[model samples]
Target: MHLVVRPLSTVKSSLFYSTSSHVPARAMVYAQYGKPSEVLSRMPLYRIHKHTLPDVKPQDVHIRFLAAPINPADCNQVEGVYPIKPPFNTSLGSDEPVAVGGNEGVAEVIALGDQVKGFSVGDKVVMAQAGRGTWRSHAALPASEVQLLPGFNSQVSLVHAATLTAHPHINVDNVEHHIGDYVIQNGANSAVGQFVIQIAHAWGLKTINVVRDRPNLDELKEYLTSLGATHILTEEELSKRETRSKLKGWLDGRKLRLALNCVGGKNATELGRYLDHEGKHVTYGAMSKQPMAVPAAPLIFKDVSYHGFWVSRWTDTHSRQEREAMFGDLINLIKEGKLREPVWEKVSWKLNASEQENETAFKEAVNKGITGFGKGKQIVFFED
Candidate 1:
């Protein structure tokens, strides 16, 4: 199927054809960090007022955003808790704060600079940079910072591209394993965890997922299993002697070589206990906001290794070709229906009517992970 291709100039012109009717687009902007209420306030949106697109350097490509996700890091960035911050550009005509919020999203290439290669106007892509002005309608980013997406079903395109921003270092091809080799992950129901489950399954790896029990435990397990998860266990289940005995039998005495941990407190420690000798545990997030503590036995006896992973940092260190290859593998998995986007609740991005509603929904979703407000991430949809 042929895809619709439009230049950045064309999109801008069509939107701002008449000056009198033009309205600034809404975005989540912040200046200082504090509580979520203090940092993220609904402010007047910005748009391309005139024909001048941001001057694209030889190494840059212009993109019209299709969708962007509000990740925990995005929220933390708004609260000034994150280390990487987007440079505040005053030239965008915003007097207040001069920052836009967002980390992950899918975009369509609208324009490419003279020095660019292997990209075209219609390619679907995701940003390599984690936190930037992705919440806005358009972005002019370095060519090397964009990872092209393989042709994907439009319904799953946004989730596939958005969730990939967190684990830029994980390459499905680099993983050496076959069906039934154990892949373990804590926070198994998280957006990233769900992706890990799907990708691991697609690669023929068996996953042992860990989650905190919710009211709908059975439903959640069913959801994870539907995504190809082999085993789903709550923290309570893992703590049970019987369950551990069953797990040992399930592995047929084979040790778990890989463990992905997002939660860093006792949960991480628990996951570490299941690791095989010389195994690797990759910690990408601290959802609990607690320091990770490991029992000395695992380090001394098992010779296990713990590594911290921040996808943004990894992407900064890797070549664009490497990043694109990882994304391509993920896209192919999605196309084959082996990978599915995590269950998400949608929020409308319409400013005039839905601004208040969106804020309430976002706040509720953010609190849900901690306070049990709801299940799953809240996705904001901006329509043309």
Candidate 2:
């Protein structure tokens, strides 16, 4: 048998490698945590003076951020309420040591460092972990913390790329329930909840989405139903027995297998009452700033489970390969047009002139509730 000889040039380009380039990177820096207006006003504006792409160490890769969303978690981080804190560095040309702000974004690989493997320049990627700055343009991170998506289609818009990073990993592939599997969510219109609804629908699961009866209820429900939501319920309806009785027909007397709770307090407790036996209630956010209280009866008799999830912590625990796989599936669904990003309000950020004005704009967007919040995710586009 003749041995097959492969060309060396093709092999080298397919693997991880770094090349020198003259691209400048910019970043948004914060000196301290406070209210959005105050803290964001204090953000120091800076651009790389020289092309000093940090020499990629064995496990590092350089990323050029395409887009990053202005998530509530990012606001919480600025307010000093978030659990994970970004490292503050004084050497970055700020008078006060500054930390970068941003949690979720999609990026493109510009270069790879020595000892890095399986990734190269021009690869589309997502942060394997959250809390790394994705606000500006470009970052150097561990290869283990960056997941490459070779099969990701560009048809998935930048807004969807930024927003999808906020969703939790639900094992939709192995989910035992089908399209009629009654799923309940409080923040039905939230970026994360919207994704949950779409993914559940694609997996043949039914959804009971709850939102406050804002002025735009009809429009919001129409948007969600377009994503396959089975029913929409307002907070007022969820509190009534008659409404709950009406839901029984949809579940066909079968209990709900999953409940997604972002707003806590009474809303969470009430949603807990509708779960079928052995169902799981996953709480990812405390939008109401209230603690969830579950009656012991459901816990002891119904054998329900309450789980709290933070995407940051989830990324830290899961391997990079696992994240790539999860994102691969998500991107595919997006490519198929089954998943879409919610309405996005763009906040333009200019270096120094409009920084203060934009900070106020950011705060205003965050203060809007339910349907009142403009639409979709609020994206900050930084321009040089």
Candidate 3:
């Protein structure tokens, strides 16, 4: 059979590993989808695999898992609610075809295929595509799916390592906006939200940040302000008519050209309320678990538009080099300390632990992720 995905570049793996050895991976996988608590059990999650890497394919890279985050979307996927699903095939070395559960993580390259290039042993890599199953202890993938983080000065936090794959922020210029155009977004405290702030700021874009009122509201506001946010407001304030007037007056006739909405329901409509003519509202997440409703006024009178973005679907259409280039820029920003990693709770996974123990900890992490906004992200790291 022919490979569906091709390597981004072709060259010899001489710069990488010399030994060809079998590499087994411990991964969390499920054959059928249902409520995560019910469908995601311990039986098959840790299983043997078919591609134990006795010999690496020409386009494959062997990777040792470092850290992987348990994202809410991942849990939703386990429940069979997420839109993009991983391919279930017998290749996972299971009794039947099953899909792995992780979407984002960091890894160390242990070996490379004969035709793989631009990577060496011990090099760090971040997931370049969603549904690549980073939950495993090891993985062998096509070079196109992983972006290399240089072994040199470009160091990143373990949290950043797992999250660099979550939302592949499109090149700002690729959006329907010009430089210095005003963009507004709610959930500015989210991993993706923080990234939007730094990315927009670094690329000469201005962002108006919005957040739900929290106990540490002042501190969170201060933190976002330091990241080059031009304006920040709470959800309560944004819902007010007077606040919109104030926002318009403060901008001095500059149109609020784009609104990034991660929280849906009324928050989404409110996000579209203050826009320049024909503004675009791109919704990437629905943390509120609410449906988006748009007022007819903006649609008929102002030509405001609503669209959805999912990073997993994006990888199917976009070039690997483009995704890697975006990753490179983000990595550079993190290395300089300009972009800060979000708060996260680290979960240690050990092979010696009873399967029941692993299941309980993972279940806890999943629940935390579902509820863990502003508090922190749930990250799983292996203990040596």
Candidate 4:
């Protein structure tokens, strides 16, 4: 990895946001941890003070962010509740140390470091590091922090690439899912759950999805079914014996190999009854805000395996090469149309624009990311 040392004179003028095209940038920042609505603020970039008579650093690349999505975890980080907290620093224009908001976004290399090897100007890249302050119009980062996609192909849309990091782990290690195995999941319409359906489809795995009954439940069911969800059931339906029997017969006596529990509570417990002997139950989220309650009988008699899934923790134990291989495979699936991204409410964030407009765009996107506005993921994209 190369280190970037900016020139002293250049750093002085760029201290509170460089008006120079060399590193024009702005970011969503927070000085103190608190609620996203209360603490998050739009701030200018502040380059480091260094020697005068400088140009773009040899080991630094200026990124023009194409698009970024606001994930639930990103909001949690801003609230100071996430395990992996972004470091707060005076890198941006501020009296006190501050951290930039956003974890996933795609950017293009408008200007490249003279010593940069693999990446080049106009090459598209995504954030390789978590909490690297992605919700910005422009950024000057070390070449190592970003990754150039295979073949340096710009064919991948920013929307699709921005979503890539959010859900690749459902198909990786932990539970050892196999092709053609029957897998079950709750919160079937969620971003993570949707990816599970598509990835399972790509691998010939069948899914039995569980969701809460909603006013537009049928439409949502149709959408997921189109994404290759084998069966869709409401929480009430999944909890009842009558509906359970119907699915059991549909399985034709094949053991349900895996149960993915994102929504805990009675609904989650009800899923265990259908598992085959020694089957695994993986809990990834508690959308219902309820604790997991597994019947004692399953552990004693049926020999069920109950496990929790945490992507951040998984990355810590796995090698970078392993993670990259999985990501590359998923991207190919998307390219082949074997995986489809959920419809997003695109929020246009213009670069080098007014503070009010930029703030409005980000505020709206962040609000939607929290509220799931229009029942879709919220993405902030640039004009050019």
lDDT of 4 by residue, 160-179 (tens): 88877666567457456556
Model 1: lDDT to the true structure? 0.68
Candidate 2 — worst ten consecutive residues by lDDT sum?
Answer: 1-10
Clashes of 3: 2
TM-score on alpha carbons, each prediction: 0.82, 0.86, 0.87, 0.85
Once superposed on the true structure, which residue ranges of model 1 sit more than 4 Å away at CA? 1-26, 41-59, 152-156, 169-175, 351-375
Q: Of the candidates numbered 2 and 4, which has the greater TM-score value?
A: 2
Write model 1 residue lDDT over 1-384, tens digit each, in one string.
Answer: 112233344432122111111223455555555556543343333221122245556667777676676677776776677898776655455565467777888877766665677677767788767766676656666777787765555646686666666655352423456567898889998887888887777767789999999899999999889888999999888877787788888899655788888888888887888888878888888978898787788889888988877788777877777777777766777777777777666655654455566556555555553343444665666664
lDDT for each of the candidates? 0.68, 0.71, 0.75, 0.73
- TM-score pick, better of 1 and 3: 3
lDDT of 3 at 146: 82
Judging by lDDT, tell me the better candidate of 2 and 3: 3
Residue-wise C-alpha lDDT for candidate 3, range 1-384, written one tens digit per residue: 111223324335445443335654567777877776556445455332334544677778777787899888888877778877888877756778888888888887776777777877677887776777877777777877787764324467777867877767743533666677788999988888988888888877888888999899889888888888888998888999899778876677666778898999898888888887888888888878899887888888988878777777676677767766767777788887777787788887774576567767766777778766425888989544
| Residue pairs in candidate 4 whose N, alpha carbon or C atoms collide under 3 angstroms | 8-50, 8-51, 9-51, 9-52
